[model samples]
Target: MEVVRIGIIGLGNMGSAHAKYLIENKVKGAVLAAVCDARTERLEWAAREFGNGVARFAGIEEMYASGTIDGVIICTPHYGHPAEAVAAFKHGLHVLTEKPAGVYTKQVREMNEAAAAAGKVFGIMYNQRTQPLYKKLRDLIRQGELGEIRRINWIITLWYRSQSYYDSGGWRATWAGEGGGVLINQSPHQLDLWQWVTGMMPKRLRAFCAFGKHRDIEVENEVTAYAEYENGATGVFITSACETPGTNRLEVVGDLGRMVIENDKLTFYRLRQSETEFNRTYKGGFGEPEVWKIDIPVEGQRGQHHLITQDWVNGILHGTPLIAPGEEGLKGLTLSNAMLLSAWTDEWAELPLDEDRFYGLLRQKIEASGAAKTTEEKTLDTTGSY
Candidate 1:
């Protein structure tokens, strides 16, 4: 019954995808009022595709002054997230920002502070968590069905990108533009899922990354990280964009059983711990460990981005809880930044990540790398393992 007007900032790949979702779904309680992008082509494309009546702006000032929208979807590149979000908040508009809210923790903190000062609903587009498989995992962990988690291993190498993919955009591989390659762009979803399901923070992390594997890039394309949790649980994070054939397998080993999600399928091996308790009394039939194979029926909406947009709209209009708040966005960015810092410094980095230290390191890398901060208006390759 209520209409939530949305203004989309940045018409890049994900921005375009969100725009399409908004148009196609005719999502309840939400309407795309305006679109903003400095690129004339993108503004024209949105006008042509959506309609000429749709207000198009080449600058944030124009969009904010247009008085045609209620909220903003920040779908810009990495570095622009914080500033765009702050501007949106300043305009008295709610915000739903694209993931990895910021490439560095300091920027995320700044964005959070700005949002807090504005008192608007600021959400993050962590659409992967809306998947049935991960939601089920989070529920199981919360229910204590997984008992005490001892270890976790997430091998998220399915995000394989070629040199041609990186070449499609000038900001693709630079520190000043995209910050870091795989960790910043590809692995944020997985990192968020990891921390979400585990409900614990890593005390320390060490990583070894491949910075020279790709043909034309200064940032890393491959990473292998070791994380030690505060609860003494250990986790392994492995990712790469250069592997020829890659796979994504996440296994969480707990005291009661082990939950494994691979290739969109979830399977849980239920360990019969009660039998061991009985064996303690009888002291017999303890020769072998007992377990039962159970395949979890994964229930999830097929279209993630669309569902995320719908939820954000509902949250703004009807007070629905956000699937991922902007604050949680910092954890993934922190982990990604820490991983690179560990690899670059050849030492383990700690969590509740050192904001000043990470930002200092990131600033140094951006200064040392001779690259542009933002990409010019052009067609971007959107077929990035979506």
Candidate 2:
């Protein structure tokens, strides 16, 4: 296939975005061939916007069988990610799904299995991974420039949503919709990066999640989670959706140095000697390792979604490595699920989370959701995204 004709399932905010860029010929070696959405209004919008050159289908299977697309980007709701991915793989099509693979890991495991069995290109929209800042941090840790990691803390709460956002119709934060709130929609990338950039996942964690803490939604809008890694490294993650003048900062402490990311700048506090080595040999009680502060250059994150799409297309055409493999998405999703599980049970959640238990509890939340929507709908943020 010289050119890949891509179909986007789910004409919601993110899917329509893919449609616009693909139709604009922004992605090399890829074209917008088809779009699928269960909503008639979205399908009509596609027809009116792209004309008949691009096919429109209400059913994904119909679009897949039409033979117009070589692959699909799943922009469906969180729960639909896995099922659609598995279907796409069964039909011998590459799959690139949006974040948080699924509401729970058990279903995502099935999707990952399908991708492995099909041997197709499976990517996820963890566009943040493309950011130069995160790349540099990962490289520094992996290269041992920071020595052994001892602690990590991230405070990313800048995603401010007006009450009208939840008031918007068909809200995804509801138990019946996304099965959770901020973590599901606004924070998946950070959750992914929490373990990804550090090359470490917490062995266990205890989380305190406040449902409707700042909003009227039923799921968590604020979260404070503490984690413990296997190597005795500790971590803290705090996120919120309604805080004003929010902050985005990350700190990683290592034996040789400390790295801080704030205000789009990376600063490293390098120790002249490893704290471990210094403590092992230093006889002076008041002495400490010398510290040097250096500011590292970093580029802003631009065209993240476009970059990820282009990477996926290139992967299909040239067998290139994917920036965010669909399987690795499970790791981030696991952390989010574990947080929710821990909060629901009022206890610590262990790694390799209990998928069945989380699944069952999520079902209970869905069954228990009885809130009535009383506000009109508003569109998702096209620039910053939902």
Candidate 3:
């Protein structure tokens, strides 16, 4: 049981949650040694919450300079992710950063390069991958049980964010601030899952997105994308920050059978062999497909971030495998970029995506966007129709 010292660089909702979990869970041998935040009030709150023994700082440099913390969890805003993680990596500290990796792909790439150069463990918090169902699915696919995935459809319309939600943080939807809407923030998990579960990459993509009804800022609130995989399998990805009583159902159809995860419940419809055997075995109509409904038990809803963090820390200390490496963080970011780029250009964008072209587009967007402020004075309503 090797001990690892932990530090956190943000004290907002998610960051505070991670810190509290570190305190409560006693995650393996990890210790919450320090906390940092730029906001004076938040920094004071974190300092008091962590008590006198825990070091506190107003910025990342101070935290790194304090010399007590080994690894740092970066839970900052969308724009700050790359710089913070890169800094931590440069300081030779293992890093765990919240998703989207960056507001743009280039930022993530820089952080990735920094991590590679520094030879430090860089983990991204796509904790949703910790779900047992996904782990099983990954295993099943690896064993060739899925037999080459043919098509996948992910409907992530449940990410509902309101105008007041956007107003809660002035940086919510601006291209320069949060980068993009649903894709950058809420859908990164699903996008990552899309590529992870399918075990593939898109060769080309065409997307349609809508700014729709949000008066808060400029950026997409709804998106629909069609992607062609390198292996010739196709997928449709639909996401929105606007929808009432929306559905989140991920369905994948492979050569073997079809699996569906709806509202956290996983069900697999395993198809029988031949039509004659199916007709002789089944009691349904002549034209009906032969299928067996299989129910998968649900795993408990513990804190995924804590579990992922523990795994990462243990991996660093004891040579265990990482749940999600920092480099993989760029996949979701790249997917988001492709979708947005496709929508912006109203054309199909080829994959093995051109990072430089996308970076240029992002630079133009950032320069065009004037200073936008963000505040936590209000809570974003995670419910609304686009």
TM-score for model 1? 0.92
Best by lDDT: 2
Which structure is stronger by lDDT: 1 or 2? 2
* Per-residue alpha-carbon lDDT of candidate 1 for residues 165-255, written as tens digits (9 for 90 to 100): 8877776788877888889888899999889988877999999999848567889889999999877889999998888689899999887
Over 1-386, each residue of candidate 2 has an lDDT whose tens digit, in order, gives 89999999887789888899898888999999998877788889999999999998877788878899999998876766787788889899999998879878888899899999999999999998988888889989999999999999999999888778887756456886666888888999999988988999999999999898767778899999999999999999999998889999999999998999898788999999999999999999999999999998777665379899999999999999998999998999999999999999999999989999998998888877753321111111111122
What is the lDDT of every predicted structure here?
A: 0.81, 0.86, 0.78
Backbone clashes counted, model 3: 2
Separately for all candidates shown, the number of backbone clashes (residues 3 or more apart, or on different chains) is: 0, 1, 2
> Which pairs of residues have clashing backbones in candidate 3?
242-386, 243-385
lDDT of 1 at 130: 86
lDDT of predicted model 1: 0.81
Tens digits of per-residue lDDT for model 3, 180-221? 778887889999999897678889999999874455568788
Q: Name the candidate that leads on TM-score.
A: 2
